[model samples]
Target: MKVERQKDEIVVRFSAGKNASKIQSILDYLRYEELTSKSKATQKDLDLLLKETKRGRFDKIIIEMGLDEKDYR
Candidate 1:
């Protein structure tokens, strides 16, 4: 996992490693939450996120948010 800051947005990168399913689930949950507030997430919103995750771009979000790996255990 790795993190980087880019202007107003933070960048996250993760390899998915051995916990790809878990990671994807968590991402789905987050997306759900974000969409919940707006009632729904458009296809474009999901597509962009999926594209980034496919490229391993979530480490920064984890790092910036300071998620503990053990916490997921």
Candidate 2:
């Protein structure tokens, strides 16, 4: 994954894997969540939800940070 500013819009690109669809859906939910803020969800809530985030979620974030997922190996 990588985040770059293309013209005026931000582009998020990822090197997808076999479970990319599940990862995409989780990401979509998170993006939608940030867009629709009704109540503040605390850190604890996020931590719990992280366990349920599909495979490739961690990989995407790691790549976005310019780090290899193997760092967690």
Candidate 3:
């Protein structure tokens, strides 16, 4: 693999023989890093978001299964 910077962009060059899925996975991680580099979110905000997401999923599952809140308690 060869990486170079030309003008304002960084270019990556690789052989076609390389695994496509592996290359895609690396690109995905790089994209995530590039996107999050400018983010102002804190760990606390992430934790709260995760908590709410889990609670929403759990509530949906409970309702779908015909289960009451006290049943799980």
Among all candidates shown, the one with the greatest TM-score: 3
- Each candidate's TM vs. the true structure? 0.43, 0.34, 0.79
TM-score of 3: 0.79
Report, for all candidates in order, the number of backbone clashes.
6, 0, 0
Candidate 1 residue 37 C-alpha distance from true site, Å: 1.9
Winning model by lDDT:
3
The lDDT values for all models are 0.77, 0.80, 0.93
Task: Mark the regions of model 2 whose C-alpha exceeds 4 Å error after superposition.
Answer: 38-73
lDDT of 3 by residue, 1-73 (tens): 8999999999999998759889999999999999999999999999999999999999889999999978775
Q: Choose 2 or 3, whichever is better by lDDT.
A: 3
Expressed as tens digits, the lDDT of each residue in 1-73 for candidate 1 is: 8889999876679985898898889889988786788656698998998988854645655667889845543
